[model samples]
Target: MSQGDEQRTAKVEPLRKARPCPECRRPSTRDNYPFCSDRCRNLDLSRWLKGSYAIPVADDESKADDDYRD
Candidate 1:
């Protein structure tokens, strides 16, 4: 390949740094490596179980409240 062609070759983007586990602040593994192990993952899961994680459930009646009634 010509020098210009080489220049045209796509540059490899560096992978972003792995995020640390919320429970231990330890670097997470590619395959359960970051948490150090599944135990850590479960520890994080427990937090969610105990109300650490919450997803808002929309109230069905709220939509009806906005509807016009005959």
Candidate 2:
């Protein structure tokens, strides 16, 4: 391999480290990414669509008070 070839064939590292699937807890694949398979990916999506996942927000009492104008 010439110097030019070596330079051209540089090793490319993945931007993020592979992690276990959130559903099955299996090693993730390049195709499915964070999930091990399509099933796991779809399952996660279904959960989101079904409102199984949610972000909690604190109720602002101050804002509630502001809604009532004197």
Candidate 3:
């Protein structure tokens, strides 16, 4: 077999997981995994940049007590 034959046979499996896109719920591509397309990916990024998504934080009673002591 030629080197070309060996090269052709050697294929790399996709390491990225294939799942539904978070933004559009469409099948994800290898290039834009977790998102279906550039548009969807960009939209998600825009939302993040715009502070549309917020992380919920719980008020720690212990921290609050310490603040009052000082």
Candidate 4:
């Protein structure tokens, strides 16, 4: 309504998305998020199954040694 209000509105603008889906490059929804859709999400999953994903594990092998020590 006023200049101050307008200035405040401008300062507190709506948040924007980083980018579209990486697989299909389509605009992503908040539900499906970065994948865009279930198909794209599954595709990404398949890529993981195809050895694209690697979950890091701790390199410290202390667990095995701890049992033997005690």
What's the TM-score of every candidate structure? 0.43, 0.68, 0.70, 0.49
Say what the RMSD of model 3 is.
3.0
Please state every model's RMSD to the true fold in angstroms.
Answer: 6.7, 3.4, 3.0, 5.6
For TM-score, candidate 1 versus 4, the one ahead is: 4
In order, candidate lDDTs are 0.76, 0.92, 0.89, 0.81
How far out, in Å, is residue 50 in model 4?
1.8
The CA lDDT at 26 in model 2 is: 95
Q: In model 3, which runs have C-alpha deviations exceeding 4 angstroms?
A: 60-62, 65-70
lDDT of 3: 0.89
Give the Cα error of residue 50 in candidate 3, in Å: 2.1
Instruction: Report the error of model 2 at residue 9, Å.
Output: 7.3
lDDT of 4 by residue, 11-55 (tens): 554366556998989888767778789999889989988998788
**Residue 31 miss distance in model 2 (angstroms):** 1.3
- Candidate 1 clash figure, as a count: 4
Better of 1 and 3 by lDDT: 3
How many pairs of residues in model 3 come into backbone collision? 0
lDDT of 2 by residue, 1-70 (tens): 9999999999999877989999999999999999999999999999999999999865887876777865
Clashing pairs in 3: none
Q: What are the runs in model 1 whose C-alpha is more than 4 Å off?
A: 1-16, 49-51, 56-70
lDDT of 3 by residue, 1-70 (tens): 9999999999878787679999889999878878889999999999999999999765777887887899
lDDT-wise, the better of 1 and 2 is 2
lDDT score for residue 11 of model 3: 88
Question: Which candidate do you rate higher for TM-score, 2 or 4?
Answer: 2
